[model samples]
Target: MTSPADLIINWDVARSTASRLVPPGPSLSPAAAAREVADVRQAAAEAVGYVHTITGLSAAEGLGEDQRDVLVVDRPGWSAANTESFRKLLRPALDAVAEKKPQLVSEGSSAQVFGSAAAGAELGGILAFLSANVLGQFDPFHSSEHAPGGRLMLVAPNIVEIAKQLNVDRSDFRLWVCLHEQTHRVQFAAAPWLRDHLMSSISTLSSSTLGRADGLPQRIVEAVKSLRQEMGQQKVSDQHDAAAGVPARNRLLEVLQTPEDREIMSHLTAVMSLLEGHANVVMDAVDDSIVPTVKTIRRRFEQRGKNRSPLEKIVRKLLQLDVKAAQYRDGQKFVGHIVETIGMERFNTIWDSPEHLPSEEELHNPDTWIERMGYTPKG
Candidate 1:
């Protein structure tokens, strides 16, 4: 049997490489950095109240103030936090992989060292890229005896940089970002079972996929090559498709080996879409009275996607971030339709239990979910 150590990737390498590879965060003087952090903390605190009022989800009973505190971090800090999350989240799947392919780890010590380093470096690169782009995230998997509910994190420098790039009011942008992330915090807070449900679902699917991961590495290489080629062709054939990067995303999906894997992926996608979409809805739900530049922010943010450099676009496609963007749109449509048709109070039932969640098909066809949930059809 492969030892636990062998099953686990060398996360230290991942952390260190990410630290080295991640771009330095936007420039800020000591005072400016302090001010930004304070502002983010304040935004997060205020956002919690707005998210509660908008979504009707509050911190679960018994959550401590420590668990609810928002941590404001820079690029490297964000990278480190996510690295830990990946470690915890992937542990079970890696164990399953090791069990299925004991020799995969039982190779000579030199091979183990090289394999760990290689895998860590690859993950590190992805983390480094994402660290630059992510403004804020709520990590539900983080836990300790003192604070079992996990912490919310805001990447201060990235938020500042993106706001500058978008040429929006800085305070409005900050609060907008907080509103989205705070919704996520409120989500897990309201549905305490959600954390375990997601973790279980992810582990189950990941185990099966990793177990059948023959030719996985070759598939990844081919996927990238094909996406790059498709991107180039789309540049000549259709500028819109080139920017959208749909083909690349489809190619990436080929990594799943079975129908069951695809089903699991779909289910997970739907859940993510709901979470992301609902957050987006809540963020936008606040009107001009609160976020005065809300309309302008939304318009420019959409345009920012169309304005990425070719290299950044390629990176985004490779990371499946384009799919994440789609989730927001698809999910937003589903939530918006449901909320408009039935109202937010009725919409709250979706979070009542895992069974109440929408399936992938239901996301595209919100009427199906509504009907299945025993709601009256829209007139």
Candidate 2:
């Protein structure tokens, strides 16, 4: 572990702060909660086999049993685990900074202590906001003393709450959520190298972005202030801008990214688009014969997003979740187009190597990718 004196973010502080700030999930009796946990775990296990059948990607080939473990956790557990992953993922960048500027991380330095606390609170707040929204996640960077490699997490309370809000069949919804997350697990398990590739890309981007640490404190403060103002503003809605009541640019992206950072971000977003879209495709690929209520689940899910409270909508926009929502839509279209064009077997070739992955432009223009891959369109 990096010494406290040399760290930029105090992860312990982040975890505790998130725990304090995250709202309690829907109330459940002890027995009901216990049953929900069992049902979720079973659904996750069931999903693994279905994902393999639909996507033809298998984790059994390379992943260890522990790596394949599925966990059911509440919002707090999700926040704490993700904070630890964030720390690990960003460690390389932090280490480089510490090595280059020893004085900035000097032991017991008041500036360092305050900066770490502020950064922790900032990150913790973000996580707290997100905890309520995420249903499930397949974390590739997951590792621990007890388990190493990838793990799938189901936010039990989030799942229960969303299902109730959608008024969908609880059993069907649990499997539906797991299907999406399991596809992610299969994707990484099938391509073990992908984890390293992503880790390297993130580390490089982080190092480049955080290299200066100039006015780091002021930047953090302004960002938190801006975010609070945006989240707290009652007027912001999906149909209206936060301040001007006009279509607005994603200010969060603009503030955080330089040109070089944007380039990296573009690549990362394209990759995420592919992954998320592919998972979505798998979700719908399974016929109603399997999930029974798949169509209703999707319809209600989309409607729920459209009907979110104004505050929820604004928070999502500020956090760039609106961008993620676009990723799922655009990505699914791209995947659907490719599959229909070349068939799923041929489309599977996209997973053969990093070079085969579509660029952001290619995601919008599928034929370009087909042409680049040396495929001719059929009548």
Candidate 3:
């Protein structure tokens, strides 16, 4: 008795209802971000094997066709049509890699490998969005290896969004972003174990949360509200500083969540730094001929990010604790200091494994990392 149009209407209503419960992002407190991040990671980890079997592009394709698992994702910055083009290009590249690298195939959907050969292979997957953000810059790469079976994932930014954000032509944005994406691909390919280490670390935290998170988000949101009020129209930067009036903020958060959760958060932050840091490095290495816009692109974009946020705050309030644009400025400074002192090559070691990734101590105190490496923080 139900018409297709009626079905469509029902679906729309359902989706709207569902979204009401979900945060719109950018405004999410660290707690909410962690919750979503964990859910996504869990789904991907669970589906890895099944996706591989379906795709026929397993790590052992060179020796024999592998029916291993694959990672499933929604394309980050693409249309259905654009997605087809990316798949056409990427599938062949991955197929070729599979032909050569039998060691990286997915074992089962859970990132569980059947054998050791496939265990340490470079793992890559894509998640896409169709918004106005730069491709590689907006895209997030979680780890260099997949655990249970080592794997890595890099979500590409929507071409549409990246071009829009960069305020140049889409082609120009792609030209610059491609370096970061390729850099990620190359590093993960070279060190497959890196992906595994990161994935396992993430899983440990995520699974633990799911086990004990029955009333979590509800509880965490309340604490986040208190923290936000303490932040009280203060710029975002003020809240993150230790000297900020916010009390037991971090510690209060941990009381509700598990250490594994904190570790995952730290690991992911390190992953983002590893990625953004390298993109800066490699773009610097390449001749300007490859992309004339490379030099001024990052700075121009950062300025836009800062200046644009008050408007963006309207959007942020829908999902996250409202923080002023200053938080990102602090984040950039943090990232810049790492790049200045470690040199891109060494700053990148964070991507190599969980062990190498900077700790909370390191994020707050780069001096510790510098001391350990016998390198002082660069001015």
Query: Any residue pairs clashing in model 1, and if so which?
Result: none
Off by over 4 Å in 3: 1-171, 217-255, 284-289, 306-353, 374-379
Q: Score candidate 2 by lDDT.
A: 0.82
lDDT of 3 by residue, 1-379 (tens): 5221221112233223333332222344667545544443343333333222322223222211211212212232122223233233233333344334433333332322323213211110111112223232211222223323322232232433445656775444544554444444444543467655654555556445534545777878876776666566555563463544433445456556656677676666555554445445455555556556755676676676566556455554443322223233333455567667765446555544556656645655666776776665444
**Candidate 2 structure quality by residue, lDDT tens digits, 254-297:** 45567787777778888899999999999989878889999999
Candidate 3 minimal-lDDT segment of 10 residues: 120-129
lDDT for residue 375 in candidate 3, whole number 0-100: 69
Position 257, candidate 1: lDDT: 45
Compute the lDDT of residue 106 as modeled in candidate 3.
39
Q: How many residue pairs clash in each candidate at the backbone level?
A: 0, 0, 37
- Candidate 3: residue 252 lDDT (0-100): 54
**Local accuracy by lDDT, each model:** 0.83, 0.82, 0.43
What TM-score fits each model?
0.88, 0.86, 0.48
Q: Which stretches of candidate 1 lie over 4 Å from their true place?
A: 1-8, 58-68, 215-256, 377-379
State the lDDT at 360 in candidate 2.
84
TM-score of 2: 0.86
Ranking by TM-score: 1, 2, 3
